[model samples]
Target: MSPTTDRTIDFTTGAPVAGSLDVAWVHGAAGEPNLQVHHYDEHTVILRQSKRVTYEAPFLFLLFGEERALLLDTGATEDAELFPLRATVDRLIDQWLERHPREGYGLVVAHTHGHGDHVAADAQFADRPQTAVVAREPEAVRDFFGFGDGWPTGAVTFDLGGRVLDILGSPGHHAAAITCYDPWTGILFTGDTVYPGRLYAFDFPAFRATLDRLVAFAETNPVTHVLGCHVEMKRRRRRDYPIGATYQPAEHRLELTSADLAAVRDAAHAVAGRKGIHRYDNFVIFNEPGKADQLRLLARGRLHQALAKLTRRN
Candidate 1:
């Protein structure tokens, strides 16, 4: 089939349908002003936006439930100008809640990692009593800029009155990275562990393990929609590039399956092995000694490669 030049793309038909989800692109730099929103239902909405970018960062999502809302990964923050994006996101949340008001609404800000781009807005919402900074590790919460209160790891469920969100600890991209799963919508709010493009890895071995766990989870759970933290296009004119302008909701036709997770794991392992024993040892050191600065460059290289390969393959 010939590719359509029309801006809108539909995931359901895997074609460029004129009428689909209403997605507006807030244009800026290559990765700047990366914001996108998907209104799933009257009570459910998903908003993904970029805060800042040293490199192309993932788009963050806001998942609204009946009683409360959850933010899946906040974007980058390299400069001061980008800080306003947090307020923009907050406004969006407020608007969402205004449309569907509940008695006692709360906000749950979670992260895929401790990266600046993904967790920049933690401090912004720290004072809100209804808001809680949830993560897979207690350190992640304590270390967060805005909200420094600690939380627990493993699988924790947050009740949203009508629906329950299960936060699963799937460390690999970052030790504190976790994925939010909504059983009712079949949507998995995957931070960086699984996205449309490449997957980053701070620790290759642990990353692979996390991918394996995700695959296993998919086998038992009905996860039809894998909502990624970031999805940007390389070339706008390319047939595969879905994101036309920045902040636009790029409709991903790719259906994530267990096999996809396995492939990512394999790719990560392959890259880790190619880096040789010394590099592998470095990851172990970083993991054990907590000497992140020691392996900063190496980790960055590995993460870049892992993400690149994942993006290319996906």
Candidate 2:
């Protein structure tokens, strides 16, 4: 694995090559198979919230180094004890510690952006010893990373001992949104910026710039995978789950490729400042809020809920 050499696909289709990576779609504490846990090498793990929990099935990532472990974006789950997020994380940390055998391991809990779905489970990490939560506000994030003038556009490195994660300035989807590149695994974790779901660009210009930045970074770096938080797409291209669908069968894979990034970038560019949904090969870019569309969606959700209630009662 040289710096100049391009990284291979690593693994294709369903899963990665046996030992290098493996994903298990296990049941949450509530007995729903909505949580997906992935072992991306020995140092990194990716956990996803299933659609059964909510439509905003966010993904939480854990990166372990020699000194400390970093968990990114606690999913929209409110109960950590029931979800057992920290306990699950503790197990992962303990395993990492077996080899290093440190008396106390430090943990930093941070968010990709200041959105409810991403930071809903923040309370889980609040009281834990040796754990710190990076504030999600734009100013607080800038202060914590010490980016100052380069707040949203600058890059900073989080050194978890030997491992370093480079955070790229990513705004648009949200002011505090960021993209994390892991040199250890060659994976870029893009929060809500680009995923298989509805790509909402509250700030169209910033979103476009962020997409361009990602494309450029992928070109310069050997990015094996472009990982996002949610999987709203189906196995079929250009298709996605609608709002308020609790269960999705035969969903899309959780990872996107570099070529997918180029496609996503083109899609975002197509909708620059435009207020509508523009479809691409894998995703759709939305520029602004649509009141009419929102009303229709709300009506449909209520109708669906009414039908469900009747069926339960019958």
User: Top lDDT: which candidate number?
Assistant: 2
Residue 148, candidate 2: alpha-carbon lDDT: 76
Task: Put down candidate 2 lDDT per residue, 32-68, tens digits, no spaces.
Answer: 6545677776667888777666667778899876667
Residue range 1-314, candidate 1, lDDT tens digits: 22422222122332111212355434444644445566665445555544233344456666565666777665665333555545665677677655555456777777766666687656666666778876535475434422223232346666655566666766666777777777666677667677655455666677667767676777787666666665532323221221122223343432354455555555565665543222221011122223554366457656655765687698
Query: What's the TM-score of each model vs. the native?
Result: 0.63, 0.86
List where candidate 2 sits over 4 angstroms from the true fold. 1-30, 33-36, 299-314
Where does candidate 2 clash, by residue pair?
Answer: none
> Candidate 2: global Cα-lDDT?
0.76
What overall lDDT, based on C-alpha atoms, would model 1 receive against the true structure? 0.55
Give one clash count per candidate, in the order shown.
11, 0
TM-score of 1: 0.63
